[model samples]
Target: MSGIYIHIPFCKQACHYCDFHFSTSTKKKSQLVEMLCEELELRKDEIGRNIQTIYFGGGTPSLLNSEELDHIFKTIFEYFKVSETAEITLEANPDDLTEEVIKMLNASPINRLSIGVQSFFGKDLKLMNRAHNSEEALRSLQLAKHYFDNISIDLIYGIPGQSNEQWKRNLQQALELDIPHISSYALTVEPKTALEKFIEKGKVKPVEDEQYREQFDILVETLTSKGFEHYEFSNYGKPGYHSQNNMAYWLGKPYLGIGPSAHSFDGRSRKWNISNNSLYINSIQAGKLPQQTEELSTTDSYNEYVMTRLRTKFGVNLEEIQEKFGEKYKLHFLKEADRFLQDGLMDTSEETFHITPNGKFLSDGIAADLFYIDK
Candidate 1:
């Protein structure tokens, strides 16, 4: 397996725009941790090779205590063959990254930290209902820098009222922190999210696509100009600092996901644990894994390949398409993509299809148009 992803499904508070599975009450935190360990042990036989990465994504993994973390680590070490130099990362929030927490993490097996500092501005933080204020976000990074070298921070752009100047300032602040990697994304209003209700109720202004595009352009220009590679659509990393766990997903490497709401993928199938924490914990305690599996069809794999590869620097290779999906699939891709190549939206010079600068903003639409769906 390329990596293992463990989801910590407890958050201090819900962000207005978030739709991910999580709970505000960490009442069952200890129980959940035990179940996660049990699930890990139960699925140990699935991985046939040494794991190269381990990522603790959240709800807010930083909420985990040292003892809790150690227990999980011990279980992992006992059950799996993890590489000595594995890129172990823990997703954190600024409020939880006190000096004590930072020092504790620094002494642990984890070598990387992905901090969720959605905004360095109080106005933006408040609007998004983020638990950390502007000062806390800045202070935590300063403290984290003293303990960690491989660090990434999450930033959200295109907040309804944020100006281009403010957006640029956010990038500049992160750059000043000497952050090696950044995962910046536009603030999207998902259905049933508070952000969506706010917009619909006129409590908040709707984010314009034009504004989002402008900020994205600003992000790409600013980060790349500072010697960071736009490795994936939303991820920018300095050389040798790209996220291994993230790359595993983008490159379609096999990974095992453990915990409520976590998703996993082998070469041919996908599985996702139940989203309900209580159901997940109960099922695991009863010696049953609460997950649903989907066996991917040829069209499913082809669509997935097109969707993910098109978003990264490693664009699709025609020969690779044919070898993996058959000649008809490759032909379909070319026939569907012929217009883009002719329009200069996609480059075909190297027998590899890459999105040109002019087409980056329309990447999702382009990828969708190329997907092979059965009639």
Candidate 2:
């Protein structure tokens, strides 16, 4: 099934670690939203299937008022063949999830909420420059659970000063709320971000490797014991609650990405829109698409399949690879995977090969090693 992803690239405030394309100013918010609706209409015929999921991601989708959201939804319904039970998700911040907002969202088409509750401690929140405090984080989830059953919360580990105890408290708090799904990640300092600058100037300690690994281990063990499926490397969900949009992506289904800086993937190629909001709006007004596209090579396709599938619980399907790509690719994969299997970094079922827990943290590197280099 196909999906649609709308990038709402406007945030209330910029977080210290965020490097995603977003504007802190709402000066062009109205125009951007209008352009987004236009983009959806422009690309309506791209995906020739019923859209099963609609994900509202980035900058902070929670910042959009009800009227803006309704207009966008109306446009989507008018232009796209959306499934009746589509999984419509909004990525929101805690501070924006006021009771009033939750009430409005409950009545809207959005069936899922991915709350960005980075940490539950004031010190961590301040360090990350999150807009919400520890109190707002809890209160938002408490109110959200009351309205939406399909909810996911984001948590971060490996903050420089976040101790094992603090990380445990964070997990315990999420579990106490009975959150069905969670997406957690290590706090990597990307270049040009405020966190990276802080580290370079010695204003903050860099993330320690040992602490990061320890907390990751704690995260895996703690969540798995509580019956959460470690489906993707950084995502865990209960049965019947896994993210449909993300799963469609991992499985390499086609999707249309609308709005500035959004990326789209058909079966054979990938494309991304221009990152500048003004440029995007201007181009749309000029009746032209502002995006770049790339056609995938066979080797490119093979490597991508390996990279995305290995991080998943289903792992790499050897038979499917052989059937779809060729025997040579599958043989090459088995040959290269020998060392990882021998070292217990990976394991193979009768039909699939997957990273073991010992290798999950290093999955990206491992996937790179197994990449299909055109020789």
Candidate 3:
């Protein structure tokens, strides 16, 4: 089964650390939605399989009123073969989730709500320049959980001044809420973000890797002790509550991404839509898809397999690697992995090649080293 993702690239405000493609000024909000609908119709035949999930992700899907959401869902139903019981998810901000909006969303085709409750501390919220306060964040979650059982919350850890105690408190608060799914991520200063510039200007302290390590350990231990499955590296879910749409990607299932800065994959080649909102709208208005496609070469495919699988809890399967990429590549990887395996960074069962707990911190570096370069 395939999935569909629609990026609503508009937000009420900008988060300091965020570098995602979005516009704070939503002057073209109406036109943007219309173009997304058009893009849906234009690429309907790209996926030949039945849609198992439809995710409303973006700058802020909760920014959309009921009417806008309805129009988009209606268009999706009309154009695509959506499963009768497809997992429809809408990513939302806590500030926008009023009781009225929650009630409206309950009646809509949307089945899940992934709220961005980054922190429950006002001071921490201000540090991140988040739009929601602690009170609103808690209220929004409570209101949505009343109607929707399948709820997920996003939490951020490792802000500049955030301490280990504060990080643990945040995790405890989330656990107390009994959220079915929790996505926790460490703060990284991505290049060109406001956070990065602030660090360069000495307005804010840079992220400390030591602090990140402390927070990450706290996160893993606390969540696992509470019986949450560390399903993906950054994602945790209660029994049987894992995100189906995201799981599809981790499992290498095909999906179609629509709207500005969105990416799509058909299990081989991948395509990305233009990040410029006006350009995206203009191109679709001109009866064209604003996207660039890349055909995945054998080496590209092999490297992707290593990267994605290594980050997962299931780890990399050597047999599948050998089967799909050939025995030569598999043996080469096995030989290359010898050093890491002996150094306790890699673990190998007869069936899988996984990273040990100590190896997770250096996962990216290890994956890069394991990458297949053109010879």
Candidate 4:
């Protein structure tokens, strides 16, 4: 099924390692929302399907008040065919979550809440420059659980000084709370980020890949023992609680993405909106969609398929490949894949080729190697 992703390009504060496009000022909030709504209406026919999920993701979607949120949802309903049983989600930060806000969200059509609880430790919070403290982080989940059962929380590990014991404690705490889904991430220092600068200046320690791998292994073991399925590389879910919106991406479904810096993908190509807030608004006001797009060549399409599908539990299907790209390309794909099979990174039978547990950590690299070059 298809989905919709709306990027709310605003945040109260910037985290040290974040590279996402967002503004700390609320001066352009109304204008931004209006532009987003207009973009939604403009791209209606491009994605013609009953949307099964609508994800409000961003710097922090909870920054918007109930009225603004309502306006966006109403516009989506007006311009798009949303399923009656669609899974609508909002990505919230702990500091923005309060009893009143929770009540407003519960009243709305949003069925899922993905709270950003990067760490429950005050020390870790300070290092990341998250807006919320440990107390608010814990309280947000407690208060949220009272109202919503379909909840997913995010956690970060492999911080500069995070011990293995502390990482284990984080997962244990989530299990104790009975969270249905969790999205755990390893901290990486992206170029030009504050974290990268800190490391370069020797003001902060750089990330240890070995330590990160250790933590990742702990994550897989701990979550699996807790009866959570490692559905994707960084996602774990309880039975029947997998995220429908994320699954749409892995299944290669066509979806519309609205707002500044949001990305959309149809099976054949990809498109993304402009990252600059004022520029995007100006373009849309001039009745032009402010975006860049690319038509995927066969080689690029096959590479993307291997990269995304390999991350999911449902591996790549052989017959589907043959059907889509033909027998010759499928055979070439298998020939290239044979290299990884010998290394025990992937397992294959006559019908399916799935990454092994050992292969999960090296997914990106292996997928890169499997990329096809057009002749």
Summarize candidate 3's per-residue lDDT along 250-295 as a digit string, tens digits. Answer: 7788999999999999989999999999999999999999999999
Of 1 and 3, the candidate ranking higher by lDDT: 1
Q: lDDT of each prediction vs. the true structure?
A: 0.94, 0.94, 0.89, 0.90
lDDT of 2 by residue, 1-375 (tens): 799999999987889999999999999998899999988888888977588999999899999999999999999999878898899999999999999999999999999999999899999999999999999999999999999999999999999888999999999999999999999999988989999999999999987789989999999999999999999999999998999999999999999999999999999999999999899999999989999999999889999999999999979998889877898899999999999999999998887999999999999999999998997
Runs off by more than 4 Å, candidate 4: none
- The TM-score obtained by model 3 is 0.98
| Runs in model 1 lying further than 4 Å from the true structure | none
Measured against the true structure, the TM-scores of the candidates, in listed sequence, are: 0.99, 0.99, 0.98, 0.98
Give lDDT tens digits, candidate 1, residues 215-273: 99999999999999998999999999999999999888999999999999988999999
What would you estimate as the lDDT of candidate 3?
Answer: 0.89
lDDT of 4 at 305: 83
Candidates sorted by lDDT, best first: 1, 2, 4, 3
Q: In model 2, which regions exceed 4 Å deviation?
A: none
- Per residue, candidate 4 scores C-alpha lDDT tens digits across 19-129 of 999999989998899888899889888878578999999978999888888889899899888899899999999988999999999999999999999888899999999
**Worst lDDT 10-window in candidate 4:** 324-333
Q: Which run of 10 residues does model 3 get worst, by summed lDDT?
A: 360-369
State the displacement of the C-alpha of residue 235, model 2, in Å, after optimal TM-score superposition.
Answer: 0.4
Instruction: Evaluate residue 41 in candidate 4 and report its C-alpha lDDT on the 0 to 100 scale.
Output: 88
